[model samples]
Target chain A: MSKKKITIAITGLNNTDNPGPGVPFIRAIRESDRFDATVIGLAYENLEPGIYMNGITDKTYLIPYPSSGSEQLLARIEQIHRKNPIDVLIPNFDAELFTFIKNESWLRERGIKTFLPEMESFMERSKDNLSSFGKKYDFKVPKSLPLTGAHQVDQLFEELDFPVFVKGKFYDAYKAWDKHEVNTLFHKISAKWGLPVMVQEFVEGTEVNVIALGDGKGNTIGAVPMRKTYITDKGKAWGGITIDDEKMLSLTYDIIRKTKWRGGMELEMIRTRDNEYYIIEINPRLPAWLYLAVAAGQNLPEAMVRLALDEKLEPFHAFKSGKMFIRYSYDLIGDISLFESITVKGEL
Target chain B: MRIKRSVAVSENGFVFDSSTGDSFNLNGIGREIVELMKNGLEQSDITQKIIERYEVEPAIFEQNLMDFQSMLRQFNLLEE
Candidate 1:
């Protein structure tokens, strides 16, 4: 089969203890039988590992972090577009998704396409608004309270109870058994992710996840359910295996059909002994372990690219149920010249 | 009522559940019982088949088979 050539720019290259989806997404795109990809790695820092990984990126450009401002981020992309002309741009970080989603028109004007959910869909599923999202959409979500300062801890236990979940607005979750632990976790999460630490009622159950993609027209492009075989301290899945879960898939389809979501997403849920599923979080992008989905025979990145190109597609129906993925770290040897290139020129 | 259709049972003791991506190893007797279950044999018939071949009493074999089946359920290898 003859494959079309496409140039794609992707962010989220900080593959450390906690990984980013960029490298794995790039790897998945590289395997697309439908498209040959020219990967342009977008980095926020000089030493992002994906920038130096051989053949991972055809070109690497250092971009300003989203915190610096969205206008600056767009300006940098405009510059990168002039040089490389991205056909599709996939922003992988949770922090950066708003910028890309807000500027969807600017990208389209420049001939860069992105299949992202509308701003309304994006905002409604945010952590602060998730409880209402569940109440409106009819899914089970644990009651959540947002904290701006440590003083709010005084009333936390009275509202909820001990052994609640301490979660960052963007990332990180830890189980706090008592008041002291909640305070410690609150300070830790707020210091890094900023104020508005979230305290969630802990659901006792086995954790299951569904990685899914949805078309804008209320159809699921693809969905794969998995149970983690191994997990990290940071609550990342280091090893996982695909499962044949009809209920998980059904719930995902219902959510997509109701929301009419676009692009990639993950439905994180906990299944209790009674077999009831509680929606934990709905992340707006593909997970770092997405290669597991690709290996299981759903190339979501490829499908997203096709969707972004406005190509008609039939929704994916099946994936290998028993496929598994294990995440590991390795050392890639490189010289100072490559590091100097990115540090000095902002491009490698 | 029967072993899961997606289960992969080997001639030896290996058992793999494709639905959950979990695998287990069975003892010789456990392997025979699983093979019988896969073949759609009833518990009484399975006990008869085992007792006819082995020296164990029917009641004893049935008790052990129940325990073995419980283990299968624990590992999520059996159909609910």
Candidate 2:
């Protein structure tokens, strides 16, 4: 019998210059002999020297954004399917995940399977979901409020103590501050990105992350806990050490079971001086350093892909529980601007 | 495969028995092998079944099974 043909369509390859989370996923596919795939970029311009261009994908397609509605996006993807007929569509970026989930049924009807969870599930597991999930698990989430306007920003500072965080609903978080700096920073953010934003009570302590892959059926296939030793300008953990913490792992499992989460997801956590773990927020996408987990011996992306393909996924191999991975950003050569910014941000 | 519960499982898969806490996020194949081990299947039997069920060569299957078993053993999820 001939080998079954499986085509995968991945999005957002042209958005960033560096190897984002998509690189590792694509690498896993390239390493695996299971399927054939064509990656489609959804950005306005082409990104060369990218992981895909650097031999990660079998083929690459640039799909232009529609000037009109989502139907255009669907039509474009459908057109690609007519030619290649993708068996699975795995979106790596947040917006791509959102778009795929929004048009999930339509794509499924067209015979393209996706690994997205329910849209409502995304909302329920969002950063806002952090506090609620924390409350359910008897943990405290930092006091936070969704920003309404620049005027309300003052009230936020007044309501809370100093060192509040001004964050976007999307990715930015854990920004440190006192009252005066936050008050000024609030206006700067509002002027750039409109409200409502997230103003969170700053939890000072060591930073940690919890990652897990689920079948969306209340089965957590695997989980990992790590600490943040370094962070990037884009708010990604640059270097980190994995640690073994019983309480944090329990909390992570509790949240996953409660949410019935699927695919790959990450949790941001803070350890107070008293060694208490406080729930910060949940990022529903894969981390850029996810490959570290795979390198540590738990290939989460491959597991998710196999599970999505209905292949029997083996229970995760037990690895070194506290294995650490430190991400080193390459090509910072002579970039004094980056150095200055790191100094100002104090994240170096 | 054998799945001995540690003091670490939280009704969810949050495992923390460092004695067996972290390991390969097993692919479907690895998961099956572990389950078989947990079920008291010997490595030889598991390899035999893997060769019969999957298209991988017997030698490769044997090596992978041994490596996977060693990994599990190293993590304290299995006894010698």
Best by TM-score: 1
Model 2 residue A61 lDDT? 55
- Per-model DockQ: 0.70, 0.09
Q: What digit string (tens of lDDT, one per residue) describes model 2 on residues A1-348?
A: 333456676654532423356666666665555555454433323333232244655555555454346777788788878877787887766545677788888998999887777687687656545566566656678887777666776667667776777776665554655656666666666555455567888888767887778788777787777776666676667666566666777777777777788777887888775657777877676666676676567777767777767887766735445566664434423455534433453111
Q: What is the lDDT of residue A247 in candidate 1?
A: 92
lDDT by residue (A1-348, candidate 1, tens digit) is 999999999998888778999998999889888888899999998878999898799999999988999999999999999999999999998888888999999999999999888899998998878899999999999999888888889887788977899999899999999888999998999999986888999999878899999998899999999988899998999999998888999999999999999889999999886778999899999988899999998999889989999999888899988888888889999999999999999999
Please give the clash total of every predicted structure, in order. Answer: 0, 22
Evaluate residue A298 in candidate 1 and report its C-alpha lDDT on the 0 to 100 scale: 93
Candidate topping lDDT: 1
Give the per-residue lDDT digits (tens) of candidate 1, residues B3-78.
9888988988898776555778888988888999999999999999999899999888889889888877776677
